[model samples]
Structures are given as structure tokens and as C-alpha cells.
Target: MYQESSFKHDAAPPMEYFLWIIPTGRASDAYGYSQAKTPTWSDYIRETGNNGADRDDFDDAIDFMAWFVYKTHKVNSISKWDAYAQYLNYHEGWGGYKRGTYKKKSG
Candidate 1:
């Protein structure tokens, strides 16, 4: 599945391409930027609700992924292992991970 995303495993600039792929694998609806049941739109999901727009889902996902990595995770240092860790942290907020839903359940 990793290679199917068409992402190089060890990118030079350190992009966790697999992170985005995981979500796509789980939800093809991600490609349409459709939130399935949530009311979230890429254009309005930001905390301020005024800093986003209807851009490509993959690009928006990448942007949000970076936000999760450098901001939410407060990652003082990055490593390959961080990609997998932060992916869950992004999927479920850091608090959600502590609550075990992020690490335990599929939903």
C-alpha cells in the first residue's frame, strides 16, 4: 500500500507522503474534499475559519499535515518514526490519542 501511493519512501526534503496516503486509502472521499458526515470544508476548517479556500484536497491535506507536525505535535525533533506517530496525532488530535480512540479504534 505504501508504494501504491506513488511516494518515494525517503524523500530528501522530508515529506511524509505516506501520511496523506493513509487517509486516502481509508477514505476515497478524501479526494473530493468531502467530509462524508462532517460539515468541514477545506475553506472553513481552519481555527480562524477565514484562512482557507477550496484548494486541491491533496495540497490542503499536505498543508494541514505540516500544521499537525510542526504545530500540534510541537515536535522539537523529527525522525522517520515521527511520520507514523504524527499521522495518528493528525487523524485524532493529540488528546484523542491519549483517550485511546486514535490508537485503538477505527472510527
Candidate 2:
């Protein structure tokens, strides 16, 4: 939450939601405190049955983040408490992490 949006509820306003795009030419579609992208958010909604979830809503954001981290652990085998690895997975999708895409970044 803090890393994603500094806990700002309106991190990505509804009208200007398309502003946050990934450098890879991918439309991030990320919004709110959780900074969750549309496809992933929809997956969360479908998986958890949280049909009314809103990214800007604190409770919903927290739930979405928790669910994401939980899924990260299940799919990536990264410990939930391992903030570093979890963050990497969070930033890079699970498939990207699995493919070592983070290692390709020229730091």
C-alpha cells in the first residue's frame, strides 16, 4: 500500500486512470492504494467473489493486497513475510518473476 501509492486513496483518479502505463508498452490500468491492474483485479474479484471491490476503498484495497500476496506465496513459493521477494513478485507478475525478468533490469 505504502510502496504502491503512499497510501493515497486517490492515487489514480477514475477519470485519469489510464495515466499509469508500464514502460513495456503495457497498459497498467493500475489504480488506488493497491495499484492493482484491471485484469488482475478482475481475477481477484472472480476468484474471491468480491464483485463490489473497489481499489480506492481502504478495506477493499487491503483485501485485494492480502489476496495478492497470498496468491504470490501459493504460486511463487515466496514467504508471505518475505517483503523483499513478495515485493518483487508484486511488481513483476508471478510469471515474470518465475522467468527471472527482474534480473534482466539494468540497475
**The candidate that achieves the highest TM-score relative to the unseen native structure:** 2
lDDT string for model 1 (17-91, tens) is 466654223332232322211233342355525365332444554454454466544533434357766665545
Worst 10 residues of 1 by lDDT: 28-37
Runs of candidate 1 with Cα error greater than 4 angstroms are 1-52, 55-57, 75-81
Error of 1 at 105 (Å): 3.4
- Cα lDDT of all candidates, in order? 0.42, 0.87
Instruction: Give the per-residue lDDT digits (tens) of candidate 2, residues 1-107.
Output: 78889999878634433456533343557888899988899999999999999988999999998999999999999999999999999899899999999999988
Candidate 1 achieves a global lDDT of 0.42
Q: What's the residue-level lDDT of 73 in candidate 1? A: 49
TM-scores for all predictions = 0.41, 0.82
Reference-based TM-score, model 2:
0.82
| Total residue pair clashes for candidate 2 | 0
Q: What global local distance difference test value does model 2 have?
A: 0.87
